[model samples]
Target: MSPSDVSEADAANELMRLAKTIAKHNKLYHAEDTPEIADAEYDALVRRNNELEEAFPHLVREDSPNKLVGAAVAASPLSKVAHEQRMMSLDNGFSDEDIAEWLARVRRFLNLPEGEPVAVTAEDKIDGLSCSLRYERGALVLAATRGDGQIGEDVTANVRMIADIPQALSGETPDVFEIRGEVYMAKSDFDGLNARLMEEGKAEAVAKNVAFDPAKIRQFANPRNAAAGSLRQKDAKITAKRPLKFWAHGWGVASSVPGETAFDVMATIADWGLPLSPLVKRFETLEQMLDHYRHIETERADLPYDIDGVVYKVDRLDWQQRLGFVAKAPRWALAHKFPAEQAQTTLESIDIQVGRTGKLTPVGRLKPVTVGGVVVSNVTLHNRDEIERLGVRPGDRVLVQRAGDVIPQVAENLTRDEEREPYIFPDHCPKCNSEAVAEEGEVDVRCTGGLICPAQRFQRLAHFASRPALDIDGLGEKSIAEFIEAGFLESPADIFRLHQHRDAILARDGWQDKSVDNLLAAVETKRAANAARMLFGLGIRHIGAVSARDLMKKVTRLEEIGVLAEAIEAERSGIEKLPGEEEKKYRQRIDAAVSEVIAIDGVGAAVGHSLADFFHEPHNREVWKDLLKEVKPPDYIVETRDSAVAGKTVVFTGKLETMSRDEAKAQAEALGAKASGSVSAKTDLLVAGPGAGSKMKKAAELGIEVIDEAAWADIVKAAG
Candidate 1:
C-alpha cells in the first residue's frame, strides 16, 4: 500500500518496524560487509522509511538508521588505523537541475560571484570497496579498509600483493602521503575466478568421493562483493590469487603538496603506478560535467569495471579548502547517480512458463514495484536450480534487479524473522497436463508434449507474429489468445490463411469490417518477407532477431541455412559416436562448419547448436515445411540508396530528446547509413545532443561533421 493510504497508527507502527529493519541492514552492509539485500533494495527500504517518518514524525525513534552516517566498525583480527583526517562521503545529485543547484550553493559558500568560473574534475565512481594507503619517505607504510569515517582496518599485507598498488614511489614522491581509492574486480576476472572456484569444488568433491554441491562453491553476488571478500582475506596469498585491481581517485592526508590542483595530484598518483579512470575529464562548465555523466552512463556496460555513478569535485585546492565539510559529506564534491536498478517487493506467487522449445522456466510474480524507472510485476527465476540457490518462497520480500541494466531478475530473498515453507518445483507443466523432464547435465526442465502443448502453441504463434518477427498488424497478445481459443489459429501457417476467417473475425466483438480488411492487407503484404524476419519468426531456441540477421548476412536462403544445420549436425553426431583418432576427422569437419557460421558476427556456438537442433527435430522439420508451403520469404539482399550518408558511418551520442536512439538509428539505416555507437576514424558524421561530451570532442578533433538533432533533420530532408 502507498504511504497516503496508511492511517496515522499504522504509519507509526510501520515507522518503528522500518527503523529496526534498516538498522539491522545498515550493520550488515557497513560493519559486517555481508549485505543480505542489494544496494537498490536497501535504498528502497530507506526511502520507504523516510516516507513513513514524514507521514508520522511524532513516532521518530532515537535509533533511526537515517540519523547515522556509517555503522560502527565490526571488530576484526587486523590492527586498526585511526585516520589523521576523516574520510567523508559525498552527497548525491540525481539530475542536472540538482547539480546546477549544488554548484550554485558551492559558489554561495565560497563567496564567489555568479559570473566567476568554477572548474571541476569528474571521475567515475567505481563500485567497489574503498581503501586508504599511506606512504612515508617514498615507501609504502600501511593500507587500510575504510571501516568508518574515523578509523579503518589495516590490510597492508594484502595491498602489497596487488600489482596495481605502488610498493615504492619514484624520486618525486611526497614525504608523507595518504591516497584513497577503490579496490575493484574487473568483470572478466570475476567470471574467471568464479569458474575456477567451481572447478576446484568439483575436483575436491571427486577426491572425497561425493557429488559436487553448487552451494559449496564461493560464488559472489557481484564483482564488488568478490573484490571486497578477496581483499579482506586473512591470508594475503589467497588475496593474491583473486584478480583485484585499484584506481586512485582521491587523497586522505598529505604532509607535502604533490600538485596545486586535484587533476594534477591524480596525474602524479597515476605516474606513481596507480591506475586511474580513463573516463575522467576536467570541465569548466556545468554542461560539460553533465555531458561527461551522460557519456559515462552510455558507456557503462562497455567499461571493464563497474561504476555506480560519476563524482564531480572542485579542481582548485583553495576553493575546496573554503568549502570544507557538511556533517558526513564533502561540500566540494557531489556524486551524480543513475536510476536505481534494483528494488524490493513481495513475491505474490511463482509461475512456470513454457517457452517455444518446451523449456519450463520459473517466473516470479511480484507485487507491482518500480525498478530502473520501469514498473515490473514479474521477474525470471531462470531455472529450478537458480530457484533453489536463491531459496525464495511465495510471500517473501525478494530483491529484484534489472540485470545488465535490462531484464528484471530476482537477485536475492531477504530471510525473514519468521519461518516459512520452501517453494516446491512443479512435476508437470503448468499450462498443459504433461510430465516435465530434465535431461542429464541439463538445468532446464522441459515438457514432454512437444507441439501438442497449448502453452508452446500459443508462445510459438505469438512469437511468429511478434513485432520483432513477422510484425502482423492488428495481431497482439490478446487477439492471439482469443483467436487460439476460438479455434481459428493453430499454426504459424494458419496466420497466412486468416483470409478464410474474415467473416467470422468481423462478427467477433470489437472487430470491425475495416479492421478485418487492414489485418488481412498487412498479412498479405508480409507474404513476401525478409529471410531474417521469417527465421526469427520460427522462434528457434537461442536464435534472436540479431542472431537471425547475422546468420542471414552469411547465408541468403532459408534452405541453405537448413542444409548447413544438417551438415553441422551430421558431423557432430559422427564425432560424438566415434572414439579418439577416428572421431578427429569428423570433429574437424564439425569445427570447419561451426567456424564458418560463427565467423558471422553475433552468431555463437549455442546459436549454431540451437539452429541444428531445430532443423534436426522431425516435428519442427514438418512445421517448417508446412509453413514454407504458405509463406514464400524473399532471399536476403542489401539495398543501398542514393543519399548523403549512403556509404558513410554515423555515430550518435548523448540523449536524443526528439527521438529515441533506436528510432534515430532506424531512420539513419532507412537512408542507407550505417549507425555506429563509437566515434572513430571511419566515422564521417557525428550527431551530438545538448549533453554530448567525449564523442563531440573526438568528432571535432577528427574534423568530422558534428550536427545537432535539428541539423540532422535538415540533412534527412535534403537526402530524401
Candidate 2:
C-alpha cells in the first residue's frame, strides 16, 4: 500500500497489525525453528511497516517491529544464557541507490565532507543461525544462540562437537571474549541430509513392520533450516551426526584490544582458527562497495551456502561506536539485500472468496513451485480488475513473485497470448446466490444480501452489538462468531434470547456461568434501547446514527418507518420512469414520490430508496420484525432551550455558501428549531441560498418565511 493512500489512523492500525505479524514470523523463524513465509515475504512486511512509520511518524506505536530485534528465548526448550553484550541486527538496503543514500547518511552523521574516502568492509550475509561462543583464556566455555539479542539458549555442548567451531583457540587470544557468528550447512550437505532423513524414516517403518509413508517424512525446507534444526538439538549426539559449520562474522564481549578496523578484527579471528567468509573485503568508496555487492550477487548461485545479501560495516570501530544505532539496527552498518524471488508456475485455477465485508476477492491457485526457499501454491489476485489486467486463466504459465508481500502476486502471465477462454467473474454471491454489485466508482464487487448472507452475518452481528449501535458489552467479534457457530446466535434478535441458551453455552468450552450471565445481562440492558441506535444496528445500507435519529424524530415510532418505506415504494412505483423519459421529468417524478422522506434534514432520496428496498426484501423485513418483537426502541426526542426559532420547522435548500447543509441544520437545532430538508405546509421558514430553485418556488407557493444565507447567520448570531 502507498503512503499517500493511507491516513494516520489507518497507518496506526496497519502498524499494529504489522508488528504482530512480524513478531509471529520472528518466533516461527528464530525461537521455534519453523518459518511460515519466505525471508523475502517477511522483509516485505518490515518494509511496509517502515514505510508507514516514515509517513506518519507520530503514529509509530511502542510495540513497532522497528523496536524489536529477534524473538524472545522464553519459548525455547534449551537452557538460557545471559549475554554480556547484546547482538544488534543490521539495517537492510536493496538497491545501489539505497546503499549510496546509506553511505551519505553515515557521512552526514560523521560530519564528513562530500566525496570523502569512507573505508568500509563488506561480506556475504549468510542465511543461517546466529550463535555466540564465549571463550575464557583461549578455551570455548559456552556457546549460545542470539535470542532477542539478550538472553539466549545455552548450546555449549552442541557447538563443542562441530569441527569448524574450535574448542580451543590456536593463536593469541583475549582473557575473556564472546565471538558471534553463523552456524550454517552447505547446499550439497543440506540435500544429502534431507535424503538421508527420508531413507532412515522408511527403514524405521520397515523395521516396525508398517507400511512406509514417504509423505510423513519430515525434510528441511532449505539449507538455513537444515542447519538450525540440526544444531538446536537437546541431545548433542544428534547435532554431532549433522554436518554443521560455524564462521565468525564479528566479536562481542571482548576484554583485550584486538583491532581498530573491522577487517583487522576479522583477520585476528581467522588467525585464531575461526572460519570466516573468504569473500570479505574492504572498500574505500560507495561505488566500489556497491560494485562488490553486484559481483558477490553474481557468485551467489555457485556459493556453497545460501546468502541473501551483502553486509557492509564501517572499517573503523571508533566510527561505528560514534554512529551508534537506531531502534534495533546499527546506523553505521547496512545489509544490501537481493531482490525478491521469482519462479514460473502454471495457473491451475482461480477461485472467488467473499470476505467479512462482502468484498469478493479472487485468489489464483498455482502449481507448487519453490520461490525463496518456500513452496508457493497460491497467490491473491486481489480483485476482478487485477485478473482482467493479467488476462490469466487455468493452464496459463505465470511468473509468481514473492516480493516481500505475504501473498505472492502474478508478476507476468507468460501465456497471455495463448488461445483460451477468458475467465468470467461471477455477478452473484457464491455463499447466498445474491446479486453482487460494485458500488459506483468502486473496484470491489459486494453482495447486497446483508444480514442474509452467511459470509457477512458474523460481522453484521458484531457491528450490531458494537458501541455505535446497541453498545452491548461482552459481545465482541470473537464471542459473536463463537455464538453463531454454536447455533446460539444467527441474528441481532437472537442476542436478546441468549438467556435461553445460557445452560447450553455453559456446557461448551471456555464459557463459564458468570461470563454467560454477564453477556446475557448486557444484552438484556438493550431491551429499551434508543430508536436511532436500534435502526443503525439493523445494518441498513444508507441509514446511519444521524440519519436514523432524523427519520425517527419525524416518524416517532419504529413501525412508522416501515409504513413510510411502503408509502415511498408505492408512490415511486406508480410514477416509475418510462422509457425515453427525459432526465428532468424523471427527477420531478422521483422528487414528488420521496418528498416526505427528503423533508427530514440530513437524509435525502438515497435513504428513502434504501429503506424501501430493505423493507421490500422478505428476509430483511422478517429479521426487522423479529428484532422489534424482542426490542422496544423509545421515540427520538431533543430537549431544546427556549429561543425565537424554537419549535419552528425550518427548511434549508440549494448551496449553503456560509456553512455546510449539516452545519446549517445543527445551528437551527442549537436555536431550538427543527431543521427540515423540504418546504411543505408544515415548514414555517425556508433558508434559501444560490440555486435554491424548486424549494424557493415551493416556499413562495406555501407562503413560508424565506431568508438568505446572511439572514440565517444573523438568526444564529441573535441566538448567541
TM-scores, in order shown?
0.48, 0.58
Task: Give lDDT for model 1.
Answer: 0.77
Error of 2 at 210 (Å): 4.0
Q: TM-score for model 2?
A: 0.58
Cα misplacement distance, residue 126 of candidate 1 (Å): 0.7
TM-score of candidate 1 to 2 decimals: 0.48
- For candidate 1, the per-residue lDDT at 115 reads 87
Report residue 411 deviation for candidate 2 (angstroms).
Answer: 2.5
Quantify all predictions' global Cα lDDT against the true fold: 0.77, 0.81
Worst 10 residues of 1 by lDDT: 58-67
Q: What shift in Å separates residue 569 of candidate 2 from its native position after superposition?
A: 31
Query: What does the lDDT read for residue 431 in candidate 1?
Result: 79
Q: How far is candidate 1 from the true structure (C-alpha RMSD, Å)?
A: 25.9
User: What is the per-residue lDDT of model 2 for residues 445-479, given as tens digits with 9 covering 90 to 100?
Assistant: 88987777888898788878876688888888888
